[model samples]
Target: MPLRSLLRTIPIEPSPEGEKGGLQRRMGTIPLMMLGIGATVGTGVFFVMHEAVPAAGPATVLAFLLAALAAGLSALCYAEMASAVPASGSTYTYAYATLGELAAVIVAACLLLEYGVSTAAVAVGWSGYLNLLLDNTVGVSFPAILSANPWDSTPGILNLPAVLLVLLCALLLIRGVSESAKVNTAMVVIKVAVLVLFGAVAFTGFQADNFADFAPFGAAGVTAAAGTIFFTFIGLDAVSTAGGEAKDPRRSLPRAILGALAVVTALYLFVAVAAIGSQPWQAFSDPEQQSVGLAVIIENITGAAWPGTLLALGAVISIFSVTLVVMYGQTRVLYSMGRDGLVPGFFARVNQRTGTPVNTTIVVAVAVGLLAAFVPLGGLWDLVSIGTLVAFIVVAVSVLVLRRKRPDLPRGFRVPFGPVIPVLSIITCLVVLSGLGLVTYAWFGAWVGAALLYYALWGRKSAARARARD
Candidate 1:
């Protein structure tokens, strides 16, 4: 295929008129937003505070704000695109409609990392909390060799709990979306309640002195912490992935996207303030305190084991939901690509009885499960942040391109300030992207290069045939 043909754009349909193979519209705004919250709250709140606090001290609160600002801007762009496109591929579908096939392929690559690796990362975090829960409740824990990744700080043979969590989520996803959504909603409530409880209890030990040496490592540290914390906000885009399955895409897409972002940001801020106030920021760095940071704080405050056990139980339960939501997003995106012939058709084969992409879910399950079992959480999280930031930048830029190229297209939601919002969104994502080190960029580049190579060698031919058939 010629370069121009390969870059050809997919038509922007006003509705699902010509989209014959689309998923069923079964989700409403509440479930959609719950999916986002389920995806967003788990890993970051439970695991990342330890990493961020050590980087920025009490100024980690500022880091949460900075990360939220960046995520919010990108989410605004996402809301617009989700409402307009209303497809399963999320940014990939948006890019295909606006930017072109090549840009869409690139966005798909970024999403593969964002959703797949993040699922693995979340599972790894879940493993830690599961161990914490078991230790507190049963007076026993998984052997280090079975519970920790080989490359983690506490090296082990494999992370068995992480792998088990991924398999369990895959089973639930294969059962169907509505069932998954119901489970996710319940998990969201549990996690949010525990976070609020932590805040209330932590407030009892609040100390103004914790803020006295805020930003001890200065501006650089704050930026670095924001970069680290950015992964927590990654699941906000999961709302857009459900557009095809949304009961009313036009209303539900924007409402769910923005609503999820607002709820997550508020909860994150509350947790951050309460956490730093409850204990000195410097203590977050102690290797012994890193794995179950929030529970430790609760233990310190109440001088009892029960409160810490409650938080650990919540973490174990809620993080499982996070893994399920993220893995679902990953499979749905792959299903879109498969339908478009960018990947093998196996992914597009939905189970008729359940109306779910069973094959795709299984594929994602095996791939993410392996990563969770072997890869270190720190590296997986950094890669997720880089992939997500780049994907957000592309989505923001696509909004500008779509407005200029096809202004007549009906949009359910539009960014309030036109180019200004998207431009700022792009800039904010770039700033966060810059904080990542050279190694992360190299890994991201290698992944993208491999994806493009596959596109050139296989996807191009398959996509051409698929388009010709349509």
Candidate 2:
């Protein structure tokens, strides 16, 4: 196991802008940043606040900063690597180009959980926001029997809305990247508008007393909350996966990645401060506010239904975009894996009409939909956090690997302070990763074990065959 088969890396030599038999490059810096924000700022802010706030009390604000530190450093590393290696597949591709085939495959497995499970988790959260919107405006909401998964607190047959959301996003992905990106950009606009509204209204009810018990649970609780909050930043790095589709991969990719991080961090802090200041952190644990976070906070703060209803509507729209972008990242990762012959060819097959990976999109939709429909959302995001943390570690490691191996590689962005920043990235990510519970570690270990087992038996052989043919 120490010395795996082949132990090779997929060659990465930048080619012309619009090479034949490749994904189209239509996205610029703005769209890419929107895509990242669309994916990064959704479920975490929308629903996970209840889960995160209760863990850190009013000091969840600190947790957000901690998670952001890890995310910020990782995004910088991602920018440098994506600029130097213009390839798709996010961490998987970057790791492969810098590390080896086995390492790439392992990262691909982590990405599967990061994007796919995150999509499912976001979809599940989406149903709650959707129900809140419906009940607020139309006087109807999905019954627990229809919206809650089997193992959720309110046991139900299945989460129908979540499965439906995944399917809809998949259909959009199959249509074309341009279409999806355009729609994501529009949703991001709507999302920002509603968040601004929430902040304004919530601040009117702000009380300084809320800060009295800010650190109730102490540093340990803050660390744990940071793990959950880090889940919100899962897709910030997804923008790097668009390297192959970016108009100027070298320049736009780095700017877009950093821009999205800045915007998302600012927005998250704004919302967190407003919500916490408006109400006691203990109120964050109220079951009703768990799924419908911002809306409930505004309603409790303003004593008006309109603001809450409006924010709920925005949550539905914004969360839809999040699920869409994360799903896109998931499919793209598989597409890149297929191109390297670690997976079936169907994954890499692009629809001539749409210029998108239709097969891959559909497969991801089905798999994620099943999970969204059946799996309970309890502690689900920890899985996403673990995966994202490890992948980020890999990115930081890849930066060092490439710098040492290919000092001559052209890079559009560079981490300031050289190895110091990358080293900090690794340390911050590790701290967050350690905050995850033993159950999450157990799950991650099993997943990584299975991936390595598959690699030892099948992936190694398939990749070898693919390399020989190439």
Candidate 3:
């Protein structure tokens, strides 16, 4: 909170990239777009429909549209940060440079839940889709003991597929298997193809009566549903994060974030409409139906399961990529903190072999792996939403702070209407966060407290501030 320390961090100086510590900015516009698509259109599109539609009925489509607006607003603020500060640490670096160390530490905590736990949650969802695909296509499936996690609704011994996927991604990181923009684009194509195929098939079975009770739970339900559906919009930040590597970052950054928002929102709305039209809203909460909404809809329409099987396969592959991207984001944030002396310097240690922060990735893998292996997907998503909402709020505030603190600074992109736009972004985030239960806030508070304690005891003493002075 000291003014001098804050000014020191906020200067638009290029971070000193040591031969071992710097990230390679090899990404271009096309790959950047794919990163947005690949990260955005995963388990959320495949699975969140079941969760949202059931709560808001036919109105869930509106919820998806509304959530997109909120996400887009935050994305705009993020674009300015990314373009003005071309850093690899995403929100962590942005907050540190703008909001000071204490705020950065808090944002880091929220992001751990947002990106880390969300990876675990997505992995669990991917596992279900994987099992469904295998059962329908190959007539072989893992039994309950190996397939379901003990922390799920109807608990099983452990979730083998989910753990396996996490470990697989971890191994890839260890081996330096970076997911390029081309790969992201291909995954997006696969995800959209499967969903389009799903929408086409689902329409054939549409029943007008399925929407009889539109807005069944009224405004409260609509807001609650929006809060849950907001999780699907988490990847919108990928666009903002790309500002550092973007071509004509100021212009291209906004275009990409807004364009991705438009594309993803439309897709989600259409899918929601198709889902409610295909079956009654009440049936959505069924674990069997929710796990494979598109697949089940296809099977019901065709009276054969191949179409459903293929959809599940597409989900399995694309969602795996989502888990990887989310994990990558989480590790990079922690690595940034380490470099800043906010966490341990050990996390900042880049592997000489892979040019990655190897120890950091391992720590993340161990944490995420335990959650994916033992916890249920649904539990993780709510926590992810809370963390993401809080982080978005921080970015929104940072936008205003940076504008006021360094008005002379050259921003590649700027949010229009100055303070008004960011204020609205913060309000939208808070409204969404309000619907979360007390228990969620408790977990969030506990995590924040722990992070602060760590900082006070160790992080502050060994901070870059001390080292720089030395």
State which candidate has the highest TM-score: 1
Positional deviation of residue 126's Cα in model 2 after best superposition, in angstroms? 1.7
Q: Summarize candidate 3's per-residue lDDT along 277-381 as a digit string, tens digits.
A: 998888788899876656777788888958766877778878877877677677778777777777777887877666667888899998898888886657555
The lDDT, on a scale of 0 to 1, for candidate 1 is 0.86
Task: Work out the TM-score per prediction.
Answer: 0.92, 0.90, 0.86
lDDT of 1 by residue, 170-235 (tens): 999999999999999999998899989989999999999999998899998998898888777878
Model 3 spans > 4 angstroms off: 1-10, 15-21, 54-57, 148-158, 175-181, 203-224, 239-253, 276-291, 351-354, 375-380, 465-470
lDDT of 2 by residue, 237-349 (tens): 87988888899899999999999999999998998998899888899899988855677787776677787778777878978999899889988899888888899777888
Q: How many backbone clashes are present in model 2?
A: 0
lDDT of each: 0.86, 0.86, 0.75
Order of models, best lDDT first: 1, 2, 3
- Looking at model 1, the pairs that clash are none
